[model samples]
Target: MWGEMLGAAIGGVVAVAAAPVVLSAVGFTGSGIAAASIAAKMMSAAAVANGGGVAAGSLVATLQSIGVLGLSTSTNIILGSVGAAIGAAGASEVS
Candidate 1:
């Protein structure tokens, strides 16, 4: 139980801190989605689905927004929660 909590805490922090790097790795950057990247591919798909335009509030758009503007407080909280859940699950499994 203690180990699980500890893992959860660590995972949450790590996930929050690494979000930017991970986003960048996947081609989401401040300068917009990188060419030939997964982000680009997603954008293309989204545009095709939405009649050649990525709709506002869509996943692709939201991600790009985050990439450009950085994560919001609520977003950080959500990320941390997800990370905590994953960490707790992993720690529980290990124990």
Candidate 2:
């Protein structure tokens, strides 16, 4: 768990740092997919925190077990895209 989070943090740091320069290039679709991936990761991590483990395919198992983050597809799409765009922009200014 620690390892995974640390890795994410490092990757996120770099991604956030470089994301802005590419946001315009990433465009709507790319940002949307990125957001969805983040949502999935967050939900999976939550599951792991509640009971899941640090085993291989644990996140997949968690997602399969819970059946979506209780959010509708449309909502996910809008939220993810918007969130990703804003997050990337904000992150770029951090460092």
Candidate 3:
């Protein structure tokens, strides 16, 4: 249980941290690019987290027992995207 939580948290943090770099790699730049990058990173993180959960032997049970995590993942994606968009806009403004 604790392991799953830890893994998810780590994954989320990693995704957030890596968003900018990943976006930049994909040719994302300027103000709004940051938001897009963050979104992409979050989506990547969720996919990774889901894979990890399956590997940890809790995928099915986790889904059955607690569905909120899935919702949280969706929320994370949306929020991340918004953030990236904002960043891109900011970057454009600066440029």
Candidate 4:
């Protein structure tokens, strides 16, 4: 249990630190989604799915918002929780 907890804490921290960098690498940036990039492709798909516009709470829109304004506290917490769950699972497997 302790091992899992430690792993979870570390994983959460790492995920929080890495999320923005990862998002940026995939073409999600402060300015906007980059053309000819993965982000653009995702947006295009989302727009098509929503009949010519990305839905307000769609994945692409949420990601773009994160890219521009960064994760909100709730979203940060959710990400950390997911990371924690994965880390705990990994730790348990190792043990």
lDDT of 4: 0.91
In model 4, which regions exceed 4 Å deviation?
A: 49-51
What ranking emerges by TM-score with the best candidate at the front?
Answer: 1, 4, 3, 2
Best by lDDT: 1
> Could you tell me which residue pairs clash in candidate 4?
none
**lDDT by residue for model 4 (1-95), tens:** 99999989988887888899999999999999999999999999988888999999889989999999998899889889888888888888999
Model 3 stretches with alpha carbons more than 4 Å out: 31-95
Worst 10 residues of 1 by lDDT: 6-15
* C-alpha lDDT of residue 55 in model 1: 98
What TM-score would every model get versus the actual structure? 0.85, 0.26, 0.32, 0.80
* Stronger candidate by lDDT (3 vs 4): 4
On residues 19-38, what C-alpha lDDT tens digit does candidate 2 reach at each position?
33343233222223234454
**CA deviation > 4 Å runs, candidate 2:** 1-69
Task: Score candidate 3 by TM-score against the native.
Answer: 0.32
Model 1 C-alpha lDDT versus the unseen true structure: 0.96
Residue pairs in candidate 1 whose N, alpha carbon or C atoms collide under 3 angstroms: none
- lDDT against the true structure, per candidate, is 0.96, 0.46, 0.47, 0.91
Backbone clashes in each candidate structure, one number apiece?
A: 0, 0, 17, 0
Candidate with maximal TM-score: 1
In the range 39-89, model 3's lDDT, one tens digit per residue, is 345444556778742333443333322222223556557645655555555
Comparing candidate 3 with candidate 4, which one achieves the higher TM-score? 4
**Candidate 1 stretches greater than 4 Å from native:** none
